[model samples]
Target: MPEPIKVLVTGAAGQIAYSLLYSVAKGDVFGKDQPIILVLLDITPMMEVLKGVVMELQDCALPLVQEMIPTDKIEEAFKDIDAALLVGAMPRRDGMERKDLLAANVKIFQEQGKALDHYAKKTVKVVVVGNPANTNAFICSKFAPSIPKENFSALTRLDQNRAQAQIAGRLNVPNNAVKNCIIWGNHSSTQFPDVSHATVTKNGVVQPVAEAVKDDHWLNNEFIKTVQNRGAAVIKARKLSSAMSAAKAICDHMRDWWFGTHEGEWVSMAVPSDGSYEIEQDLMYSFPVNIKNGKYTIVQGLKIDDNAREKMNVTMKELKEEREMALAACQE
Candidate 1:
């Protein structure tokens, strides 16, 4: 067999990593034929827990993973790795400010980003699954100067999927019928799930974007409010945290990027800006993207109606302000 692909997951001891490492081994993200060399990294104490997880992965005998490594050294763990999953972070407690969370996580991602610049494989694509993930991803990419800015993304696919499922349920069709749903801006509550561009269908007929069969107006303000707040609902229901679904988002984000987007179908991801759709550079805000030839390019020239533009603008503003705050903190 050809050499396995080297994939790295920081914070292998965390709950999201708990689910993600197994999925990677079983070919959930990478293809089954593509064997993976799983490089697991965490703080020193988590190595023991990560080791137990690795032992189970070994027994499963997946064609996807050839080996697993549990390490604490950022430089060594990321060395020449194919893809990096960043799930380890300083999570926000109930009373903490977002800036405080970002400040703490920024320090962690910065060191790793430098290590990635020095040691990660030339083509490593990073997905940040941590809290304040968008800003953390921005900090990580900023530290790694040589890598293509497009190679870094934060997880917003979960919000996208959540919106799609909500629409599908409302329309009484399978989730597959929902297309072109978007989560623009930060992965936090500020995300805007716009279905304005979607073609929702049921049975054999296509319908407009609406919450009800009678009313074709789901891309309206109320639905936008609902989709953006769905994260809080999940937290309330689970009464703990959003780990499993977050892991699923990490899986879906990479899977769609690696596999081509469905023909003419675009999804939401927090790709870096090249001034696409008026988003500034390096802010890590979510945008509508279609993957072609293993690269994600923002879908261009879509008619941005007034509501869409307003939503995009608000999210972009939050990202821009966050970027400024981060730069100031970096100087401190």
Candidate 2:
């Protein structure tokens, strides 16, 4: 067997982590042949809960999970880690504004980012899964200057998967039949789900998603709003934020990133922009990206209609405001 890769997961005792850890152990994130040593971290108060989680992993006897370390120490958890998932953050409660939540998470990511910079392998890939993920990712990357900006990304795949599923359902096709769906800009409600270039396969025939759905009115209004607000709808229905689907999306994101996307296919990731589509540089913004040889390139040359441009601007504006708030917080 190959040497076990050290994988660190923050917020190890939370609902999302609960689902994520098991999937990783089962080789859902990493390939089946690759072994992993999981380093699980949480706050001191949650150490006992983290221990219970470790015990359960032990009970499963998953061969891919070569070793498990549960700790409250960031340095200990991140030491020589190959990949880190920043999943723990203060969830927005009733009456909490976006800026308020961003402020609270900024402090957490800043400290954790420093630990990652000091202890993790320079090539470590970090995915920020916490709320206000795009901004949290930017804050973490800001503190970890030694790491390449390309090494950090936010989890926009959840939004992308939701968009794909919605499109497939509308066209009465299997989920795998949908390709090239893009979730652009922030992960918040201001996000834009673009199917303008997507294609769907039905009855052994492939065609543009717009052609398959045949309802521009629904696509423009209900589909975009539904994808944007799906998280809130889940919270309302489940009495808790989405756990399983979120974890699944994280796995999907990491898998595609590490394993590469299929030829001619792209996935959505919130990566540092290089001024593509006129987006500002250095912001972790969602774009359609194609991966190969463990590197990603933003998909280029797609025409952005006036409506899509309007939606993109709205989310970009929100992200810029959040970036300003994060900068102010860092200075404070």
Candidate 3:
């Protein structure tokens, strides 16, 4: 058997983490044969609730879970972790402005990032799953200067998964038949889900997604809007933010990244910009990425039309404003 890996999860008592921890224990994120030591962390006030979570995990008796550590200490949680799922953050409540939410969450991630830098293994893989994820990831990564920027990513797979499902449903094909769907820019409503290069397989044959849909109007307007506001739509229906789906998307994102994507397939990940597609430096922007040999390379040479460019710019502008707000607050 391979050596057990240590995985750290923040917000361990919260809705998303409640869904996520059980999944990880069941080897949903990692493989079945792999063993894991789960280190769960939350704020001190939540420790009692987190203890109940740990008890339930124990009751499940999952074989892959070798051990469980529940803590309110960030340093203890991050110690020697191989993977860190930074899911804990202040949620945007009713009447809360976006800038206010960003400011609040940035402080949380800033401290956690420093703790990871001080405690986590240098090779640790970090995914920021909290709100304002792109900028939260940016702030976290900035403090972890020792860790390579490429090792950091924000969650955009939820958007990508939403796009794939929408396209597959529209084309009357299985979800697996859709490939190369990309979610670009922020994880917010401004995100652009582009299927320009996507393909749908039918009866042992493949065609471009755009050809299958055959309606630019729907793709540009309704499909885009639906995927962009999916979280809000879920909240409207269920009276809660997306927890189960978001957790599942987090699993998919980490699994694809850890195992590698199949050739000719790409997924969206929010990584620091290296000036790809003329995006400014130091921003965490989502882009089409291919993973192989446990490394992600941004897919190159995709054509962006004027409309797509305009939408991408809108999201990018939001990220910039968020970054500015966060940086100013951090300086205060």
lDDT values of the candidates? 0.82, 0.93, 0.91
Candidate 1: residue 193 lDDT (0-100):
83
Number of the top-ranking candidate, with TM-score as the measure: 2
Q: Using TM-score, rank the candidates from best to worst.
A: 2, 3, 1
- Backbone clashes in model 3: 0
RMSD to native for every prediction?
Answer: 1.8, 0.9, 1.1
Task: Give candidate 2 misplaced runs (Cα > 4 Å).
Answer: none
TM-score of 3: 0.97
The C-alpha stretches of model 1 lying farther than 4 A from their native spots are: 211-219
Q: Tell me the tens digit of each residue's lDDT in model 1 across 252-314.
A: 899888887988789899988888777777689888899987799888887788877887888
Ranking by lDDT: 2, 3, 1
User: Candidate 2 on 136-226: residue-level lDDT in tens?
Assistant: 9999999999999999999999999999999989888889999999999999999999999999999999999999888999999999999
Of 1 and 2, the candidate ranking higher by TM-score = 2
Cα-based TM-score, every candidate: 0.94, 0.98, 0.97
> What is the C-alpha local distance difference test score of candidate 1?
0.82
For 114-201, candidate 3 gives per-residue lDDT tens digits of: 9989999999999999988999999999989999999999999999999999998998889999999999999988899998988999
User: After TM-score superposition, what is the CA distance of residue 219 in candidate 1 from its true location, in Å?
Assistant: 4.4
